[model samples]
Target: MNFKQLGLSDDLIKILNKSGIADPTPIQKQSIPQIIDGKDVIAEAATGTGKTLAFLLPLLENINPKSNEIQALILTPTRELAIQITNEANKLKEFNDISILPVYGGKDIASQLKKLNNNIHLIIATPGRLLDHLERKTIDLSKLKTFILDEADQMLLMGFKNEVESIISKMPRKKQILCFSATIDSSVKKLAYRYMKNPIEVFIKQNDIALDAIEQDIVETTDRKKRDALCKVLDEDNPFMAIIFCRTKRRVDELEAVLHTRKYNCEKLHSDIPQNKRERIMKSFRNAEIQYLIATDVAARGLDINGITHIYNYDIPESVESYIHRIGRTGRAGESGYTCMFIDPKNIKDVNEIEDVIGFKIRRRNVEI
Candidate 1:
């Protein structure tokens, strides 16, 4: 249905039309009604399915402009996600004139503290930073009406259970809670059972690798041949943007150095870099200023971007789910993409598991070095 038919304000509808969001996505169509009606919801939808806007729009539509205190709080798993959510929230300028702030670690807390005095309608934050604000009394959640946990599964994976629990305990008892995820891990399910009140569960089809619009292949190789093989593939494909997934920080560093030595526009992302640098790296990558990004799983998890042409698994992932998550970087928003995995003889089972979940065999590409 049209956004106008969804009971959205005229101003919001106009904004959506201008932004080319005329029709609501399935999740939006289903959940917006419940969210606007002030219901706790447990929605399971994959990435790029408009989960952010699904929740943000209703929150913006239901905001109490009369109140100066924080009214809605969104807890995300990563700093990048927190920033992305806050950016999207700012696009609701047609609906309200309230502040939307993003709070996360590795940035200056003083700046965020300065923003606390404003009329913030929505606060999108990471768990650790939110708990910090709660402890310092810098954030007033007593008037909170809606609380959202975006990417609940990712948060649980990052070991934020205690912090998330503490943050939840501080919110008002009468608030409407919403939790959205790609996959509802057991911890997330348990959290919903404990905190949500008669929540409506909405599960869309999980995004599998085979169902994605990405072509997959494996390059069987030895450790010494992997670098040369990757270089050959890069020369052949000449991708506009690509991410090379390494298994360790050393590998990421070495790969970056080697690519730099070869004059490839590349950068490294890992836990070792400070947050500011990471932000800059991502900004460059998003703007197409950098063509290649080398990263580990921890750094690359939850990265949401568009127009990624290729994803190279420099090392085979031990967890089968990770293979899905990695290739998921490409073939987004119904666009066709490609993924190449460098596999050793011993890692055949890992590749097989990925194929089993995706329900298809990845075509093999042989490159004799």
Candidate 2:
């Protein structure tokens, strides 16, 4: 249905039409009305399912344009997601006078402090940085009207549970809470039970974890031959754009170096890189200026790029959930995609676990490396 039917304001409807967002996704259709009605909601939706807009649209609707205080707080697991949400909010608020500030680590805290000192209406932040501000009294969430925990599962996975709880403890008591996550584990449920007041549950079951459009396959190779096997797969597939998932920063650096020396247009993303460079790399990758991006799991989450034709698992992820998230990057927006995993003999157990989680066997293929 349309945004107007979702109880959004006329101005927001006009803005969404101009931005080419005429209809809402399943999650948006289910959760936006409840959220706009000022109810706590717990949503279980996968990545790339238009969830950002699901919470963002209702958030913009509830915001008071006349208030100079921070009326809304959005806590994300990564700086990338905070920035992405902030960018989306800025785009939607182009015709309005609302001010938003994204607070995350790896950037200039002084500049963020200056912005915080201004009449910011919404603050999209990571838990740690928000705690820092709360401790320093740079941010006053006493006036916060709405609180959102985007990617709650990711936050818990990243060891921010205590920090998130602490941040939540500092918000106004009577404010509305909205939580959106890819999966609702026991911990997520406990968090919701503890914080949310009679929350509405919304689950959008799409493909049951693995996208049907993704062609999943595995290439068995030894540790020494994985690089050559990956090269062979790349040559055979000839993807328009791809992300090569490595397990560590060192591996990403080494792999990116090797790929660059081989005259491949590629870049590396990891925690060691500066935030500005990482943002630039993400922008380049989104624009298809870079064909290959070698990244670790921490660096890859919250990447909402479209048109990714391939995903290369240069290293098997540590968990089944991570594998799902990595492959979910591709096969988005109804486009057919491919995922090739170079599995060493040692990580066969991990692959098996992934297969068990996805409830299917991945096609195994041999490449002459």
Candidate 3:
């Protein structure tokens, strides 16, 4: 069904229509009406299922613009996620002068403190920074009517359970709680039950959308020779655009430095980088100005850039789903793409698990550098 039929406000509908977003995804279709009606919800959704807008569009529709209090608060696990959600909220601000702020580290505190006085109606924030604001009494959540935990599973995985609980305690207990996560483990369920009031659960399971148009390969290399293997693949493939996924921020930084020394057009993206620089790097990558982008899994969530021809898994993720997300960055809009994963000895089990899900043994290639 269309977003208009999902019970969104007319203004939001017009905005979405103008942006060429006519139909709603399964998560959006299920979650939007409930969220708009102020019901608690727990949505089991993946990153690419348009989950961001599922909560965002309804939240915006239900926001009371006349109230100065921070009517809605969205807590995220990482700085990049906070910024990404806020960027999305900003795009819908044309309706009734809605004020939304992104509260995260690496930005000026004084500037944010000043903006806090404007009475931001909605805040997309990381748990730590939002807690900082709470402790300093610079922002008040007492009037918050809706609390959304985006990527709830990631927050728990990042060890932000205490911070998330503390933030939730500060908000009104009767407020609507919406939790969206890729996986609904026991931890996420506990969090939902503790704060939410009999939340309505919605699950959206998307098949392997990337497997059709993408060629997958496994490159066998030791950890020491992984860099050389990556270089050899880049030289041979010479992709128009590529994203190299690392498991952590340190790995991204280290890989970017190595690729730079080897005279490759590359940049590193992680939560530690300044917000402005990250935006610039993403812009450059989207414009095809950068040949490769090295990023962590958290940093690359919600990234939807077309023309990505190749994906490189420099450090294999432990889970099968992360493997899918990393490679799914390519092969968009019916465009053919390629993914090369560099696996060391210890990563054999991880690759085996991933192969089992994909239902085929990926073609193995030897890298001699």
What are the candidates' C-alpha RMSDs? 2.1, 2.0, 2.2
**Distance (Å) between predicted and true CA of 267, model 2?**
1.2
Arrange candidates by lDDT, highest first: which order? 2, 3, 1
Count clashes in each candidate, considering only residues at least 3 apart in sequence or on different chains.
0, 0, 0
Task: Give the per-residue lDDT of model 2 (tens digit) for 1-369.
Answer: 778888998988888889777878889999999999999999998787789999999999889888898999999998888888998899888767899999999888999998877799999999888899999999999989999999998899889999998998888889899999988889999988898899999998745544788999999888888888888888888889999999999999989998888888899998789888889998999899999999998788767898899999999988876778889899876688899898878887888888887879999987976
TM-score of each: 0.93, 0.93, 0.92
Compared with the true structure, the alpha-carbon lDDT of candidate 1 equals: 0.85
lDDT of each: 0.85, 0.88, 0.87
Q: Which has the higher lDDT value, candidate number 2 or candidate number 3?
A: 2
Query: How well does model 2 score by local distance difference test?
Result: 0.88
Model 3 lDDT tens row, 1-369:
877788987888888889877788788999999999899999987666678999999899888888888999999887767867887888887978678999988788999999998968999999888899999999999998999998898889889999988888888867999999888889999988988887899987647354778899999989998998999999999999999999888899898999999999999998788878997898888889999999988888767677899999999876987887778778875678899999889888888888898889999987779
Better candidate number, 2 or 3, judged by TM-score: 2
Clash pairs (backbone) in predicted model 2: none
Cα lDDT tens digits, model 1, 1-369, are 877777778988888788777778788888888999999999987665677888988889998877788899999888878877877778776566877889899978999899888778889899888888899999988889999998888888889889888887888888899999877878899988798899998876644333458889999998888999999888888999999999999999999999899988999998789889999999999998999999998788667787788999998875766677788788876688899999888888888888887878889997866
In model 2, where is the ten-residue run with the lowest total lDDT? 204-213
Report residue 254 deviation for candidate 2 (angstroms).
2.7
Top-scoring candidate (lDDT): 2
Instruction: Give the clashing pairs for model 3.
Output: none
Tell me how candidate 3 scores on lDDT.
0.87
